[model samples]
Target chain A: MRPIVLATDYGTSGAYVGQLKSAIYTVAPGATIIDLTHELPEFNPRASAYLLASFLEYVPPESVIVGVVDPGVGSARLPVVLEGDGYTFTGPDNGLFSIVARKLSKARWSEILLSSEPASNTFHGRDIFAPVAVQLASGSTPRLAPAPAEDRAGIQWPDDLHEIVLVDHFGNGVTGIRYRPSDQERIMKVHGEKVRYAPAFHCVGPGESFWYGNSNGLIEVAVREGSAAERLDLKTGDPVGFDAAG
Target chain B: MRPIVLATDYGTSGAYVGQLKSAIYTVAPGATIIDLTHELPEFNPRASAYLLASFLEYVPPESVIVGVVDPGVGSARLPVVLEGDGYTFTGPDNGLFSIVARKLSKARWSEILLSSEPASNTFHGRDIFAPVAVQLASGSTPRLAPAPAEDRAGIQWPDDLHEIVLVDHFGNGVTGIRYRPSDQERIMKVHGEKVRYAPAFHCVGPGESFWYGNSNGLIEVAVREGSAAERLDLKTGDPVGFDAAG
Candidate 1:
């Protein structure tokens, strides 16, 4: 069976992430659940959308990816399942899957029609998305109605965003801009600080700030042996600009 | 097959935790790996010890738990396999398993005689502990030599510690004290701030600080809808005191 990958904003703090796993394991004891990340920028599904999309290439094909950065958990947002390329995505309809759908070929969106009301209004990740993901992984058909493409959240969002989307534990600021080797000569500006390009950390001196194509194929700002987030005062949603190197 | 549970201080950053999972999957693709936590107090096995012990009652029986909070990864510390109660543990023998051993009846310690030197000195969690855990989970015997109890690190340490061992993402301070129903009347003091006892977070008003028995059965300090870590200026390793309430 394809791995059930969990991507959430639940920071692994309390019982929420554990409950997601328990909810999955309760039915499918043999299912393999991989935590893609639980520390996505909290409540900012727009930023999380780009970051989650960046990880799609690394995840195994045909995997069930559950992205739950829903700030509208108790609101009227729809729960969705989007089949992108060979992967199946489950999460709230709040544009979290928008970038993911765009990156994959022949993506299809569907609204999950629950068999019954969820146990809690505040935790659809455990109640709705996890069970739905388990059903997908187990090859069982869930009640899903075709969702219109026009109504999809973030459908009109730019293919690539130009803001810091995640600050990882190393203090590396992962921006939404895709990094290609062709753009090696460009300088990236964040919070008024100019960062030149480097292929990798060792290419730069200690404590020097630089931008690089991270392993996930995104432009990540980092300070060698230091915190780039601290040096540049960067956080998620901070705008980043690109310019030709002087 | 028994499940492999990972507890580390790797903090879900960078690629350490992912690599540990990959290492296990590479050997045992069917392994059910549960991340008990990766956010243990960094480089301090003494604190991690009490916290790991607190979770022992909750983990499934006969699970192979891999605990890696080693500050001396590349050093002379031995990689050890410890059996406590029915569960097997693999990690650096730097007192990470000390408290765990004390908690379980008939615990035994053995030095892992590696067939080859670990590929990387700094990441025994990936190279040593993960593989060892897979072997145990797969019902295979790893090459282990009996380690004397007298040579064990933290063998003579106190049964309980009086310090905050972990500050969780919710800003709740988890101390080393085991909470029982009898301790409800005791007042807890941390960093010169006195806190009363409450049955749980909901028992107190918003922003009111109190101490309670956490789900894991440890005394935790928290402020409802606020951060106890900030409210009491608490951090891991900060001393905590208990007194009878007037």
Candidate 2:
């Protein structure tokens, strides 16, 4: 079995993410669980979708990724299992998997029923999705009902985007726009400030904010030794355009 | 082999933690790495000390815990490894593991030589400690020169403390003081605000604030549906005492 990956907005603290891991461990002892990230912006399904699409490249094939940025957790939204090119995702139908569901070469989705594992009004991530993720890792295909691809959450985003998707610990803002080597000449502007293009952090001058390709291949805004997000007041979902100064 | 756990102030979204994991994977392929928490109060060793002391109980025995709350990351602080009761710790001797070193039975201390693994001026957690952790997990015992136990960082604090250790996403503050079920009648006072004790969150009405034992067995301050830390202006290291309203 491939590793079980967790992508959520559970942050680094609190007991939520740990509980999810515990749930997996209880069923699949010695299962490898990789935390791609747990710092997604809560209640922002589009950003979660974008992050999942980019981050899915890093996980091992056949891995089951559980993404739970569902703000409508207790709402009438559906629970789902989406099979991407080679990855499986189990989470809320609130569009968290929208981008991946559309971009993957082969995307097949099914609505999951949770009669055995009753979820609370909140935290279906822990109750419904986690147990289901363990069952998937255990090689058991649980019951699945049909759901239209249009009903997927965050399905409206295009295959690529030009907005901030993540702000890293160094305050570098990772944009949803994939980097093209041919487009290194293209600079990005945010909040009226022009950012030139740099290939990596050390390539830029100290305290100068520049765009670079992160390890995950997203175009990221960063300073040499300082924080780009702080220097430019950039955050997730902030719009970007071709720098007028260019 | 026990899982390798990580606890640090390396906030989510940095290439820092990922780099550490990548370095570990380079040496130990398919290693199971668990993130205990990364939201520690950076530069505050005491808070990290308290958090490690409490959180260690949950990790698997014989696990190598790479704790990296190194405010003095590049400083001359001695890099050390501690063999605790059933687990091992690797990080700077910067007091992050002070509590666990003292309390764990048969604790052995040693200074780690980094000549084999040259550490950069910054981010020893990635270059030095992470490699050492991988070596430990690989079942290879590296050289450990003798070091005085007193030389351990942050060893001055007592076993039991009365300070706040963390504030979670829900605005709940996790305190260093362990909850004695017998002391339920003893209300806790923080910043002169008295907080009555409740066995659990559901015991209180909506929007009500109370102290309860979190799943980790630590006493935490929380509001039923609100944020206790936000409402009370509580933060890590705020002193806690018995309420005068007794």
Candidate 3:
């Protein structure tokens, strides 16, 4: 059976995650559904994109990744599907898959249009993306739903590499560093200091501030015995570091 | 912050889940841990063992997975640190990692001996497994606390496959088949002019019933629109199946 991973801005508190799973099961009937995360901070598309893109390589190939961080659902923003590198992506066209597509190099994409039947203004997660993903998981052809849009260029990477997109549960601000640990020291400078690689999260002194390459392989600012995001008053999507270095 | 995922048999309503997370964060400051699941049924080691073995592949390779379904925590059972395939697994060594280790093939394991350190009889999940997992995530080597045990070859897989281990939220009985669609057809057998593979949960029709094959890739008896685990007298680790083919 094909594995389908769901990445969304929907938090676990609501029925949103459950409903989406139910819908996928309704259509696919026998699909293996795994939750990448439903607790992404709401409507943070870039954050959602970064999280999905960072973890995309680890999931099994041919896995259908459905990302639903659309604040622009039912609007002019297009719902699209991109097939590339032995994987399928279904989500909004707002640059969510850009990083992933860029990493994979070649992506076959098509903009999705719902049937002439009336669609809900809100909850496109349930109405649009979930059903489409279900069908796709069940081996339905992509051409059955909608035709491809004429212009399908990839999205441009954000100019600032040091921009923080997600502050996780421990309040460590996660950045979008498209660099490996070897190249990270030179690619970006943080807080007027060259980024240092600590052996582990608490390798630095207790309560002392430190910057290191995170497990996600990005430069992150953290505290040894406290919350860096909380103490620094950082939230998701806040830009950090000098623009010239990026 | 490092991400820690918990796989435990402590049901959600209990204080075990809360305490484990609390203890983890207490020791490993600035850590971002997540619950893979806390709803595992009681101390059913086979259930917890299989669930962890099946799901660990989907998570990031370096993730620290804490499995705590120890019925023999303070008893003769060994507490172990298993290092394998970019992942670290901590739990009671009651053959929980046996299936996982076999699946990964490259798994290198060592036993965690905390006997001299003193531990609680009832709650080794908090004192032993939880703390060890936290320390591991906080950047400690496995040798910090205990020396390795020589006889690490005794771990074994569950011999019986007919028992139902977990009934999911939908009342689908999660069975040993790890039910995939390919198993759907073979699930029903012809017995003396009788036919099976009917899509009903119980001996009913026109409503949701547990047949077989669920999202987890297991042979489950699931109620389509309701809870079959509730409707029929099924609970965690209950034996279930058709006596005769068809």
Q: Give all TM-scores, in the order shown.
A: 0.61, 0.62, 0.53
lDDT rank order: 1, 2, 3
List the TM values for chain B, per candidate.
Answer: 0.97, 0.95, 0.80
Instruction: Indicate the worst ten consecutive residues by lDDT in candidate 2 chain B.
Output: B53-62
Chain A TM-score of each candidate structure, as shown = 0.97, 0.94, 0.85
Local accuracy of candidate 3 as per-residue lDDT tens digits, B113-189: 55455333445676677778877887876553442433552354553355567778766666654654554454432
Residue range A1-246, candidate 2, lDDT tens digits: 668899998877754676577556646658888888888975578876777887777789889999888755556788899986678899988878888877688788899976774534455776788778888887888788878787666667777777888888889888888777877887788888878887777786688888877787778888889888888888888997667556
Question: What DockQ do you compute for every candidate structure?
Answer: 0.10, 0.11, 0.03
lDDT of 3 at B103: 66
- After superposition, candidate 3 runs with Cα above 4 Å error: A144-154, A183-196, A242-246, B1-5, B8-65, B68-109, B112-246
Give the top-scoring candidate (lDDT). 1
Report every candidate's CA lDDT.
0.85, 0.79, 0.64
Query: What tens digits encode model 2's per-residue C-alpha lDDT throughout B1-246?
Result: 456888888876668879888988888887878766778877888877877777665566678989888777777898899897879999888888888776687788888876664657788988888888888887887777988887676767877678888888878888987777887998899888889998655567778898876655668887875778888999888898777665
Q: Over 4 Å off in model 2, which ranges?
A: A2-9, A12-136, A139-246
Note the residue pairs that clash in candidate 1: none
Write down the worst ten-residue block by lDDT for model 2 chain A: A117-126
